[model samples]
Target: MKEYVLLLFLALCSAKPFSRPSYMTLKNMMLEDMEDSDDDDDDDDDDNTLFPTRTPANPFFPFDMLPTCPFGCQCYSRVVHCSDLGLTSVPSNIPLDTRMVDLQNNKIKEIKENDFKGLTSLYGLILNNNKLTKIHPKAFLTTKKLRRLYLSHNQLSEIPLNLPKSLAELRIHDNKVKKIHKNTFKGMDALHVLEMSANPLDNNGIETGAFEGMTVFHIRIAEAKLTSIPKELPSTLLELHLDYNKISNVEQEDFKRYKDLQRLGLGNNRITDIENGSLSSLPRIREIHLENNKLKKIPSGLQELKYLQIIFLHSNSITKVGVNDFCPAVPKMKKSLYSAISLFNNPVKYWEVQPATFRCILSRMSVQLGNFRK
Candidate 1:
């Protein structure tokens, strides 16, 4: 029986086995896989669509979410806005890279040193409408990039000391500033716009040469108690607003230094007389606002204003308007109604300048000529 079984297996091995399908053969599958691998080798690494290397997921770290802003302040990107927050003091936890900080309309009573010590990147600071009574000398010394500072509507009695020299605009309007001591803004040569209006600045508070070398473009000391024009105003000033003061007269030397003055606002004052040739010093002067004053006659030397465009002498006690006062500008005035020589509401003779409306007290009455006829 064993021999018979061995003979049968030998016979089956020797005989041609039933032909297996090519798909069911292991060698055929291995050959197909090799062909696919050879085809993949032709592709470049960039064209390969392999999964990207994954970074280990890090859990949240508190330092990554930095607490750079104060508790109640709203910080967006790099600006911190704490206005109208009733904050009595500056939050010391401000970010070092903060660019603009608006702390206006708050109850901040004082600004001490180190309140903004390390903030070197700060540019604009708005502290307007605060109850700031005092500011330490070095309060803003470290902020070297500070440019625009608004301290309007504060209770400050004097100009804050040690202000950043890089400031381009400084406004302290509507404050209780009693005096402007000598060298108050000594090194602020870069200052451009300065507005100290509506302050109770003393008559002699502005020291001589207080604004000696500054290239200030705009200066406003209006609504103060100045009896006379402050001596030695910066000659670089373009627009000077000194209206609403106690100035009784204007001397020739009062404006001798400002040759480039454009707009002069001396209205709402007690100006009774302006020295002869006072307007001549300002050769480039365009507009002179002497309205609501006590002038008896127009200031002499208006003919020298080659660039004079407007002279607002309305609501004054002027009794006369000299022909020479505006004759030099009449030629240009005829071409354009914008060059107004408004002498409205003055007690001057209406018929002197024929065809001009002078009896109209309800409106600003102006002298009429060919161009001014109404």
Candidate 2:
């Protein structure tokens, strides 16, 4: 009888059929389970970010990050300016439509062919003031529209080949170039200005007609190692600066091709003599600088420069000059083209010193009429 009563009491306290838990209690339990799952997912995301399964490191920047230009550079209007940034190579992220690129004052040592491959709109490229030593032969062949290229003040050893024909101005001064090949400027028909001063150019390294068929106006090969004037210079040249070379004399036909030359600078050389009629071809010559040379006497042919304006014979060993040699027709030339002559620091003695105000034209009338030093 006792066992039956205990069983009835247990059945009354136990859960009956079709009975369900409270709705609030079930909702709370689901919320707790979701919170635990979210925590586990957060830890997984952190691990993947640290060691991404897709890549070793993230290649793309965060979407919220801002685009940054090169250090110490300015980018605007599709032009990238990274001058004086101490760059060792050309920046690879330049804008596509960049019209100008100024990479001057950097430490770039070499330029590969693909450096500027896709810069089709680039019109000007300034690479001056860098440590550039070698440029791939086809480095600039792709810059078809490039007009001006400044490669001065560098350590280049040779003139780069395959230059674009559209280049109008190329400045490569103050370099270590030792020679100029025959085809250096072969197809450069539109090249009008070339600055190649301060190079150690070899005497026989220049091939014949290296600068043929160009409209180059000014040529600066000063301080080069030329023992004599290079032949076949362009007739369109207006000014020629060949100062500080090893030339010992000026031949008559040296300048026979330059009829339009206006100024000639041959200073600081070993020029001991200038042959007669050496300067007769340059009738339009205005200024001639022959200072600091081994000249013992003024070249009598210089008197034939009808349009001569000034002649610098300072710091030379000249001993004497004849007034008749330079001014046989002084009365007639005084009205037109008498030039200023500087003879300072020389032992030169003029037998007939005219008035300081007299302007005279040197004449080639007679070589025997004057007692000029031989």
Candidate 3:
């Protein structure tokens, strides 16, 4: 009699069956498609391979339960986010159409190729401040439509290059990057913003054509081990960072090709002089940083920068400022302060001494876009 009653209870409780296919099947399918793409392209010419690769192309975002981005902290019911409860890997329960995925504080160190197998609509993926060390090259290959990628505060040494051609923004601050590949940003025409702060650079590590073809707004490389700037920088670059480097000189040839550059930073380096004509090509540059260096004089060609605004030249070993580098611009009434002079942090020779000192540009709030230094 008890056995009969137990069977009835089991049937009643397990009656409602839903279809939740195991993720393994989808993982295998995606892998097989990847293998086929490789086999099809091994020797086949690009013209002969007319079939579109089987990778996820058009991602459809379904926000039913996958809308709220996940943090390493908690979980949220698609509508109300609570917290992530000890997730070791990317959450499997996330609806397929999740757009932005923030895995900031997770202990996830490894990302499998199929981790992002089917989700196509993903745009922003922030994995900052994680304990990750190794990441596969193709870890983001499937995310062709991705836009902004933030991987700061992790253990990434290798700069993520060969990114999808559609990338726009990349941030990777505070990492142990010894070298950077030349082909790192090759073919990234649409890229605009890049940050690479607090990296220990190597001389041979940055490939000659590393930033061959990218037009961007800012390229922050402060607190790096760079000895000199690459000569082939795109003229379209607006802002630059050369702080905390080993650079000793800035010759006229250094700025000969930078025509449209606006801002420049050369603080905390070994620079002693700014060669004349070095500022000739930099027409649009308004603000410049010459702080924390060994400079005793300023460049003369800087007069050509008619749009010069604020010039940082503090924290140097200079005893006296040069009498004749350039005259200051008339301070405009507008908030667009284009004044040229260093304030605080340097010993002025006489009472009338200008170009005397500079200050720090530790714009911490500015989004960093460089190596992910942990």
The list of candidate 1 runs beyond 4 A from truth reads 1-67, 329-338, 355-374
Tell me how far the alpha carbon of residue 257 in candidate 3 is from the true structure, in angstroms, after superposition: 2.1
Cα lDDT for residue 191, candidate 3 = 82
Rank list by TM-score: 1, 2, 3
lDDT of 3 at 140: 75
- Please provide TM-scores, in order, for all candidate models, with all chains considered together: 0.76, 0.73, 0.69
lDDT for each residue of candidate 2 in 194-223, tens digit (9 for 90 to 100): 888888885787778788778888888887
Better of 1 and 3 by TM-score: 1
What candidate 3 gets wrong by more than 4 Å, as runs, is 1-87, 321-324, 328-337, 353-374
What is candidate 3's lDDT per residue for 311-368, written digit by digit as tens? 7766665555543344334323222334446634555544554321211122322211
Better of 2 and 3 by TM-score: 2
CA lDDT, candidate 1, residue 137: 90
* Model 3: lDDT of residue 298: 56
- Candidate that scores best on TM-score: 1
lDDT (C-alpha) at residue 40 in model 3? 69
